[model samples]
Target: MNNQNVFYDELCLSIYTTNRYFHQLYQIVLGKYELTYLQYMVLLNIKQQGKSTLVVICRNLDLDTNTLTPVVKKLMIKNWIKREKSVTDGRSFELFLTNSAEQKFELIQIEIARIQEKLVGDDQQQFTKILSQTHTLNNRVQELIDELTNKK
Candidate 1:
């Protein structure tokens, strides 16, 4: 195989491994709260964005609606979030945190901070730099995917 192919394969493997490792850590930290990484991410995003639509959640999380639908349903059932039809947009519904979700948000934030501190410790500067670089790379990858899909 060509060097370019080898590089791409290695990069993909590294990304997958990193994601898996972090997910395992997240699972451990969030286990007591009965939340998965994706679920917590959805909550956090909604909390940050303040009354977001399903399309916004899907886009922010880089997940499809099918994958997010069940999670949102679960959250609604748990009384951690609520959904309501947008007054301006009849087709879209907005998501907002419930009282319980707001109460738990600070605890979740503390746990995540602890986990991050444990993992990165003194190397936080390097971790921040690497995370920034990863964001740039992810955007580039998305652009490439969009270009390829458009071509097809």
Candidate 2:
């Protein structure tokens, strides 16, 4: 195979492994909260974005509505999030965090920090570099996606 093909294969495998590891670690830390990694991601996004709609959440997460709807329902049932019809768009509902979600976010931050500390050990610099690289790569990937989608 060509070097580019080999590199692509390696990159794909690395991303798959990294995703699995992160999923396992998230489960270990947030299992008690009864939230999956995706669910936590949705919550975090809403917290950061103030108020969001289901379509926005799905777009931001690169998830389909079918996959996200059930998770939103679960969060709603737990009262961790509130959903209401958007005045601007009757078909879309706005999502917001409840007081319980705020409390949970605080706890999640502490627990995540502890887990991150343990995972990084003494390699704070390496961890920071990796995070920076990941963010850059994510942005690049999003740009690629936009280009491809625009073509369609």
| Best-matching candidate per lDDT | 2
Clashing pairs in 2: none
Could you say which candidate leads in TM-score? 1
Error of 1 at 89 (Å): 4.5
Q: Whole-model Cα lDDT per candidate? A: 0.90, 0.91
Backbone clashes in candidate 2 total: 0
Tens-digit lDDT string for candidate 2 (25-127): 9898789998889889999889999899988999988899999999999999988899888899888789999988899888998999999889998998998
All candidates: TM-score: 0.84, 0.75
TM-score of 2: 0.75
